[model samples]
Target: MRFISEQRFDNGCLEREFTLGDIPGILWTPSSSPSPLILLGHPGGMNTMYPRLASRARRCAQNGIAAATIELPGRGERPRSAGAERARADLRRALAAGEPVDEIVDRLVIPLVDRAVPEWRSALDALLSLPDVRGPVGYSGGLIALGIRLAVIEPRIAAAGLFAGSFVPRCMFHEARRITIPLHVLLQWDDEANDRQSALDLFDAFGSREKTLHANMGGHMGVPEFAGDDAARFFARHLT
Candidate 1:
């Protein structure tokens, strides 16, 4: 309803703070009915207000849902934290001090995946603190989305909407299977992040009673206007 305010939460290692929008986002309910929330996480190079995310936020607002957009550390106004690059280097070193096969994927294989969960949880917490906040919430994006889903499986999040992302299903599959939340996945025909097969793999792994897969005929950023409306409809059915 009103611009609550914005605050910065550190990644625990960085002095530069990450910004979160608490005001002027999408809000459909009266801020008391416990509606589902939509939290956005941008790609490494993008921010919360990018066209794709902004458009969806507006649509969600029009449809009577609250929407918040988020940015990862160093991607928005901040730069990489001191020793962030070095910490990544150390993780690589630790992972490398093992067998050759495991060493190849090594540090990035798990630590990076492991680190993202908390960030999403923190963002969700911030979004839910508003007046009419509700239980079921969802996320969209690449590693950020996958990592968050991997961490917590709350049935309150009655549904999830994913676009162009997947995770290590083998390691995350058991937890992933626990997700009874309906899933709506969107993928571009020419997505370089793998292919439609990647989205299919995630969908099949989830085994939700309800699921929808859409293949749009566009490049990475060319999601149709219909997708936003579809997302609103899906969340409304499950969240409300």
Candidate 2:
């Protein structure tokens, strides 16, 4: 990792921006010592500087946990893939036409998951190599399909804070059954982009006995601030 710039917050947290190969990322750590790391995944279209991501990272830092986020494939400085564009166009059309959710899942969600999971794993490897980071890593944020795949395949993640506002691919239900880490899934009940039943189905499919659901009655953008607090607490408990 090559350092780009850094700033120190009044709360004694240091936020450093860096580049890993072609990917842009940021790491927030307590100024005093190394802490457990949380790999934050941003919602699609948002990069490492997204308000929620930065806010959550600062929150984790305040709680003595390190937080890091890397740009996803086709995002930030990474070159966009033609396949990703095609899949996104298909998803937009399907959602606009009120097409069946399953078709959208098959056409877009699965392809995105296949492209993103490997990138996430690679980013995790780079983040863990940093001197100020420690084990007992946790994952937070969404693009729920990516979370599902990571939870199922990445044994390094001890817990996850998954946002369920995105489409849940049909194949992911089986993968969800394989996730055994502690999970805290947040859902917006009235989200227009998500199939409510599908979200419930995905959450129900998680095999982790320690999973908890925090559902609120609002639109996709209405996730309350308290939900973030709860997620920070969840990560602190598990990752710490």
Candidate 3:
């Protein structure tokens, strides 16, 4: 990891930005001591610097936990391609039309996950190499597909807090069955962009004996502040 810049907040939290090869990322560490790390995954169209992600990192730091996030494929400073743009457009159209998106998801979302999951693993390796980060790692946020894949494959992640307000491809259901880590899933009861049944199905598909679903009645962005607090407590219990 190559250090790019850093800023220290008045609360004694240190935030640093870096690049792992070509991937841009940020790490937040509390002032007192080394803490367990959480790998935050941003919502679609957002980067590591998205306010929610940054706020979550700060919240984790306040709770004596370190956090890190990397920009997903086709995001941040990564090079964009015409094929990616077209795939995104097709996904949007498919979602808006309420059509079967299996083909589009297979073509687009799977490839994105294929590239992203390994990068997340690589980022985990680099983040943990830092002096102030410890083991018993956790993962939080979305895109849900990437979260599902990571939960299935990344043994380093002891727990996961996933947002279930995105489109779920059929294959992801199978992947969810393989996720045996402790899971805390958040779902919006009336999320405009997501199929409620699909989200419920995905949550039910998780094979973790310790999985919990926190469903709230609101739109896609209606996850309240307390929801984050609850997730933090969950991570504290598992990661710490």
Question: lDDT of all predictions, in order shown?
Answer: 0.53, 0.82, 0.85
- Which residue pairs in candidate 2 have backbone atoms (N, alpha carbon, C) closer than 3 angstroms, thus clashing? none
Residue 16 of model 2: what lDDT? 88
Off by over 4 Å in 1: 1-35, 45-49, 78-109, 142-156, 165-170
User: Where does candidate 1 have its weakest 10-residue lDDT segment?
Assistant: 8-17
Cα error, candidate 1, residue 78 (Å): 4.2
* Full candidate order by lDDT, most accurate first: 3, 2, 1
Rate residue 150 of model 1 by lDDT: 43
Top-TM-score candidate index? 3
Cα deviation of 167 in candidate 2 (Å)?
1.4
Query: Which number leads on lDDT?
Result: 3
Model 1 Cα RMSD, 1 decimal: 8.3
Clash pairs detected, candidate 1: 28-64, 31-132, 32-132, 136-156
Q: Which scores greater on lDDT, model 1 or model 2?
A: 2
Tell me how candidate 1 scores on lDDT: 0.53
Write one digit per residue (lDDT tens) for candidate 2, span 109-171. Answer: 676678778877887887788788876788887777788888889999999999998777787
Clashes of each: 4, 0, 0
In candidate 3, which residue pairs clash?
Answer: none
Q: On residues 82-145, what C-alpha lDDT tens digit does candidate 1 reach at each position?
A: 4445554664575466423223233333454454455555566665775566656665554524
